[model samples]
Target: MDAAARDAQGGLEWRVTVPEGATVKVEHEHGAVARAWAWLLACMVMVRSTVAGFAKRVWKIAVDDPRKAVHGLKVGLALALVSVVFYTRPLYDGVGGAAAIWAIMTVVVVFEYTVGGSVYKCFNRAVATASAGVLALGVHWVASKTGELEPVILSGSLFLLAAAATFSRFIPTVKARFDYGVTIFILTYSLVAVSGYRVDELAALAQQRLSTIAIGIFICLAVCVLICPVWAGQELHLLTTRNMEKLAAAVEGCVEDYFAEEPARPAQVKSDGYKCVLNSKASEDAQANLARWEPAHGQFGFRHPYSHYAKIGAAMRGCAYCVEALNSCVGAEVQAPEHVKRLLCDVCTRVGTQCARVLREASSSVATMVSSKTLDFAVADMNTAVHELQGEMRTLPSMLTVKLAETTSLMDTMPLFTVASLLVEISARIDGVIDAADALATLANFKQVDNDDDDKKRETEMKVHPLNESDTDDEASPENQITKV
Candidate 1:
């Protein structure tokens, strides 16, 4: 049934219509043999796709983080062991069925990338669980002893325990690392104590929970440490090295973007150059902390000199600050005078390239845990480049001063002045970075010092500059900031 009507604007509108007898028909007309062949072909196609999809997904997961596969395997094995022990009559009767659940949770909580972190967490969790179980048993016994004080004893004990645990979390030292353990302790205590009120087997329940958690922790520790273990320190060192490379790349990119005669490309902004350096600070800090928790092994000893890691981090921040300033000077909003642009281009070609190259060397050197003499040469070249940039910047003020003297109004010269100021600031920041690099080199024992006073003086000068607060921190000292190269 089709119909036409006049629209509001006085135009005829045709409406979609289906005939009364019209039907959507999907008919299969293949003969018996042909239909069987079609069905077989469709099944083959579906099977092939399913298999391919499964294989592709497996590859993707493995490629993303091969360690993830290892972790998964470890978890599975730990859980399986718990299940096997739980199903066996003797073991299951000895500990209680609930022991298996606690064992599973232990495996979930104790696994960490570094053996040190895992062990540390395992110990903390095991101790916390044991302590909580004991306390819950004591609370249950005390409540049972009281004739009419069961509710009061249980509720009041919970309130006190909850308040104390919550207060401990607010303590700065505990909150950073052990907060999770504290939270689990509180939860386990509450569950055990509260649930024990109805169940007559409070002691048995507590014992089972503690035993299961202990077993799980032991399994995780053994598997993580003895197997293909990954060290957080190694990861941290690698991250630091990568960040160095990223920092160098960022500097070069920012220099190119700022001075290029052509318009900035969309792809340029999205590249790893700027974003990598910009987002590195917090990630690097966290990784370093995790690394610190890792036990000394391989190249690292009990007295592993990880303090140098802090120095390298600070140096990266110094480099990052300069790079960020350079990044800010990009885009159509800012423009420099023709002569100033030429000067910048020349500086970038000479100094910026050297910075990136040196940083790349430093990154490699750090990863290898070896000091390179090349950093000294890089520092020398960087010094020359900095001086050259300083000379170019000095000319700007002279030129601007002349213009200001000749013309009463400073408006025309202000934009160029701002550009010159940024260049000068950039030079100043590079000066700090150079000093930081030297400091880093010295701390890594790569650079021998007859007298530390000279390095100290240079660092003092860097600290005076107000380009950023990174240089003012105690760790911003020359020794606290370093790179391998």
Candidate 2:
């Protein structure tokens, strides 16, 4: 019946006919919503203050070896699921619910895309914060439509919203964008049909629900600001950074060992380089865990601040190993100086190919990150430089080919100095690129957030009401201050 009313012109006419002194707080969210904002701030501070370690770990991992860190998303996501389950009390309390969240997040994600962000690309906060706003609006709309509260409608709406969110998981990240406003619209319908709340009371309701809304924001922000940085710094200085130094030492040692009077074979060098790459990858993972996942203080979140810094330190090591592997491939001739072998050539080709691929992926991640941001000044310079380095990665094959040909000119001469020199150069270049990108990203972290505390998770109205865009757009812009309840 409510759906029919939404379809028909007069269905919701009564909502607009407010009494002389009825409450409406939309036009002035800040006027009465400041109290709710404080609560939200408190919640955010408390949660972030608590989860310092988790955020640190996530940052560490992202920097150390983003490729490996990406692979571990399943574990991160699983833990997130567990956390979500533990927080279900908010749902029964009528403060929050899952489907409502999904609808909101979906709308935010889509809105970001419309405004030039690529969904699921680089700007994680935009997606996350936007989602929060979406959920708030969706829930509020539903409450307005219904004349009385009906858990069933909200519940069903939640189920549908969840389905939509789940579907979003499978979207081709590089393809067309999706907006989940449809789900929010549906939730709004559910709430309005049974929420005993009149359409006109939405502003007041948003104000009334301030406590719940503030709490959630506080939770997310606290995790980011209070905990992860310090521990993450140490983790990088120790594990990842230390491990990289060792990998460098090992590369040099292995090359010398393979060549000493004993006449080592290409196989030994190849195997050793492979081992270093694998270890480098693992270290990157562990470091990211410490940096990106760990919250600053609390043990509740998945981030491990220390781990993220360690990952960056470790990735730097991996860059070193790539150089070593390339060296070992080229150096096998001089070290073994004995056995008739074409084996080292094969090793060089393989190592170079693999290292090139890694750099390519690394470059792509940066580009994607750039595309996701509304403001690029924070990272533009770094992005441009690293982009060039990433490009240099592809140039490795040419350099190697020229060196190999030069070695061949000797007609049985092993390219010892030539390979070593090239390996070192490649390693240095790649590492330099990764380092610059990491540092720039670190600086941008502080700038990611806009100053406004109340992030309006506005819904993308698929079907616009008679209300003009001006009438409906009340969310915060970066320039304006918002006090959402």
Candidate 3:
């Protein structure tokens, strides 16, 4: 016989009594309720962790750029202003629920973070909507006149207009500025053409949509321009200036790391700092395009030669490429001998430092909106450093011939040669950057520094007080030293 009984621990146990008084007991497994509780606990933990992580990311974003938070609020304000149309009786009657939906949709689509971006999209949407509506009305009139071929006429018009608009998107100039407009044109045209077939009040429908969308666009533009406006022109100017500084820092860092007694570790190499310049082309182009839509704001005037920034960025990237190659030399496995590096160390460092100084001065000129006379001086110093480097290079063969004496392989010297050559090329590229910056200054009417008087006074002082040997030595530091070998 088998019987069920509760054990001392209060768990269910099954006991079987056999002949000769032998007994066996089986413990009960846990019930489904316990498993359900465990699963529920796991789900709670996962949900809690997911929520915490999402909140952390949101907080980080909001903190990193408070402008993003402000932009969000501006968007909300625009939406709220447009939503009043639905609540007011007159507006509700004029713009029906169906049309009011378009107003809301327009606000959502047209409101951008930057004032220029919002203006660009709003203008595009309005013009595209108006143009498409008028064209649709004309096509509808023609289709109605032809009774038998009405459907054919409508379909043909749709095909031709849609094809033309889509093809226009492939054009570079059109795609950059008017791509959004073309897309909206196609959507508005298709809606009116297809719906006009079934509905008699096509003109009223188109008018309601156009008027409401215009209202939405007006509200969006007002909010974007008035509420803590972020100007694309200013952003682009700052970005270009910041990139120049980064280029300078990258050049300095690369040279420093390369000539360090120990080879740069992977971590040091990874943080080369030139990556920002390499990846900034897209952002620069986008900002330049949007900036053209903005009116005069802050230091940037109307039609403020924003295109010159693209040229400057291109020149910076060219220099950045050389810096990247120089960085690679820092980690090369086959290094030049200690003596070979020592031979060119002072000249290389001097040239690199001067290149960085030139970049920094150019960047400062751009940032301050001043045509810096000091920038000319910096360029002159850079040129002198380059001459000194060339002089060192001329003596390098003879010096290496004596020191190496068939002891060093070609592979061992290649890294040093690459670093030296890149530094020289980088110095050449700095001239392009300087030229672009100068052009921008000229076009933008940057404030010119009057330093002739200061220069003459300094020259007079220098002529009166001659430098002693100690003073000459102090002035002829490693950076100012002209090395022959």
**Top lDDT prediction, candidate number:** 3
Tally clashing residue pairs in candidate 1. Answer: 3
TM-score of 3: 0.86
lDDT of each: 0.65, 0.42, 0.83
Cα displacement (angstroms), candidate 3, residue 421, comes to: 0.6
Q: What lDDT score is found at residue 439 in candidate 3?
A: 97
Model 3 lDDT vs. the true structure? 0.83
Query: Clashes per prediction?
Result: 3, 91, 0
Model 1 C-alpha lDDT per residue in residues 1-485, reported as the tens digit of each score: 22333645357454445557653332233356688999999999999999999999999999998998997887777677767667788877776765667777778877886775786688678777878878887787878789699878988999999899999999987876677779878987888767834445777667777787777888887888777888767776677777777777776676666667786664564224546655766766555555556676887666455545666677667657666666665654646544456544665445566566667666766666556544554555555565666675567557556654454333543444444455455445545545554564555455343447656544554444222212322232233343211
In angstroms, the error of model 2 at 427 is 6.1
1 against 2, candidate with superior lDDT: 1
Task: Please give each candidate's TM-score.
Answer: 0.71, 0.31, 0.86
- Clashes counted in candidate 3 amount to 0
Q: In terms of TM-score, which candidate is strongest?
A: 3
Displacement of the residue 149 alpha carbon in candidate 2, Å: 12
| Whole-model alpha-carbon lDDT for candidate 2 | 0.42
What tens digits encode model 3's per-residue C-alpha lDDT throughout 164-260? 9999999999999999999999999998888745335888788888889988988888889887999998999999999998889889888888888
